[model samples]
Target: MNLTLKIWRQKDANAKGGIVTYQLGGVEPDMSFLEMLDVLNQDLIDKGEEPVVFDHDCREGICGTCSLQINGEPHGPDRLITTCQLHMRMFKDGDTIVIEPFRAKAFPVIKDLIVDRSSFERIQQAGGYVSVNTSGNTQDANAILVPKDKADTAFDAATCIGCGACVAACKNASAMLFTSAKVSQLALLPQGEVEADRRVLAMVEQMDKEGFGNCTNTGACEIECPKGISLENIARMNREYLRASTK
Candidate 1:
């Protein structure tokens, strides 16, 4: 396939940025979006022009580092698919593709397409983990069996990959869904009960500190999440936070 890419270019977070257009040809339908960008970059290199900068790791869609706003959609127009999982065939020949980075104050641009997502790390460090000390023959799973329903819910919540697609897709740039997923995952598990109250409070506080907007139930985050995590987790987080803050 042949195409034109209008990609955002910026030297750094402090620099002025604009959309720069380039032509791409001979793209394979099966090639992942990042791979197609690689071909474009190679072409730019051959012409002695600065190549487009983007992020990608573990291109199997596990890392969630492949962030891109393709034609006004996060990770392109695919459902439950990360940018790395997006294929060139999604576009038509001679199409003009608009590519941009995930925009949010919390995610300052580092270069062309990469952003400083350490804010997410800081939020995770706030309370995203269980404080349990497991060693020397940890208790058998059967010793403390949580309800199967609760376990399943917790597992589903735990599937969140922290991709920031939720933020990218939200008009308000909210991280509530992402933070809530982490909160709900632990809040539902027995091992996470010890810090449940404090965990919700801390994570919510950190999320707010990171300048993420509040969730107004527009549901854009759930729609664009590559993991297909639901807005239900956000509701769970709200309930947990309310109960925790009261106590």
Candidate 2:
């Protein structure tokens, strides 16, 4: 199939950016979205032109690095999948696809379709870990029994891949969903109970410092999340924060 792609192009974070259009032909329906971009880049390179740059590590959707705003939706129109997992068959022949990077104050474009999502790392560092004794006498993790429901919920929350889609999909560019998922994963587990108050407090504070907007209950974040992380996590986080603050 032949297609038209209107992609964002920026030299760097400070550079002025705009959409550049190119015609891509012979796109196989089985090709993943990133593979389609790869074909486009190869054509440009063969013609002595600069290629469009995008972030991608693992193409199987495990890594959230392959992020793109396709036709105004994060990771395209597909549900529960990252850009790397999106297939070209989702589009029709002669379709004009608009591709852009995830936009947010905390996710400034580094170039082309790549944005600096290091803000997520900073938030995670603030308190997304459980302090554990890693000495030679470390206890087996399975020794601690967690309630089945709580364990399931925590596992669901832990599936967040930090793709910044929550921020991109929000009208306010809020990172609440992502932040809440991180908080919930640890807050629900006994291993993370000791620092629960401190973890919630620090993580929320760091999220604010990262310039992410507040959650307004619009629910866009959860809807756009590739992992389908629940809005319930946000409510849980709010409760955690309130309890932490009162203490």
Candidate 3:
């Protein structure tokens, strides 16, 4: 298939960026989106031109490193999939694909399609973990009897990959979906009960400090999330926050 790619290009964080168009041919329908980009890069390299830079770690979609905004949608037009998992078949022949990095104040563009999502790491560090007693008297995690429903919900919330698609999708670029998912993952579990209040407070505070906008219940984040993380997590987090604040 012949395709026209209008991709964003920026030399550095402070450099001015714009869309650069390139015509590509012979794109296989079965080729992953990143693989199509690889073909484009190889062609450019053969012609002594600089290749387009994009973020990608595990192309298997487990890692959310391949965050991108395609034609105004995070992770392209697909539902419940990351950029790396997107296929060339999603576009028709002679289509003009607009590819850009995920846009958010907290996710400043680095270069080309790569953005500094380290803000997410900072938020996670604020209180996304539980302290375990690793001394000689450590309790077995398997010994804890967790209710099946709560366990399922916790597992669902834990699937968030920190891709920032939630932020990008929000009109206000809110990180509430991602932040709430993190909080719910721990707040629902017995092991996480010890510091549940502190965890929610710290994470939420860090999320605000990172310049993320407030969530207005638009539900865009959950619609764009690759993991299908639910808005219910956000409600659960609000309840947790209220409970924590009251205590």
Task: Write model 3 residue lDDT over 49-132, tens digit each, in one string.
Answer: 999999999998898889889999999999999999999889999999999998888999989999999999999999999999
- CA displacement after TM-score superposition, residue 122 of candidate 2 (Å): 0.4
lDDT of 1 at 215: 81
Cα lDDT tens digits, model 1, 40-132, are 999999999999999998988888788999999889999999999999888899999999999999999999999888888999999999875
Best by lDDT: 2
Give the residue spans of candidate 1 off by over 4 A: 134-137
- lDDT of each residue in 14-117, candidate 2, tens digit only: 99999999999999999999999999999999999999999999898898888999999999999999999999999999999999999999998999999999
Count of clashes in candidate 1: 0
Q: Considering TM-score, where higher is better, how would the candidates rank from best to worst?
A: 2, 3, 1
For each candidate in turn, the TM-score is: 0.97, 0.98, 0.98
RMSD of 1: 1.2
Number of colliding residue pairs in each model: 0, 0, 0
Candidate 3 wrongly placed segments (more than 4 Å) = none
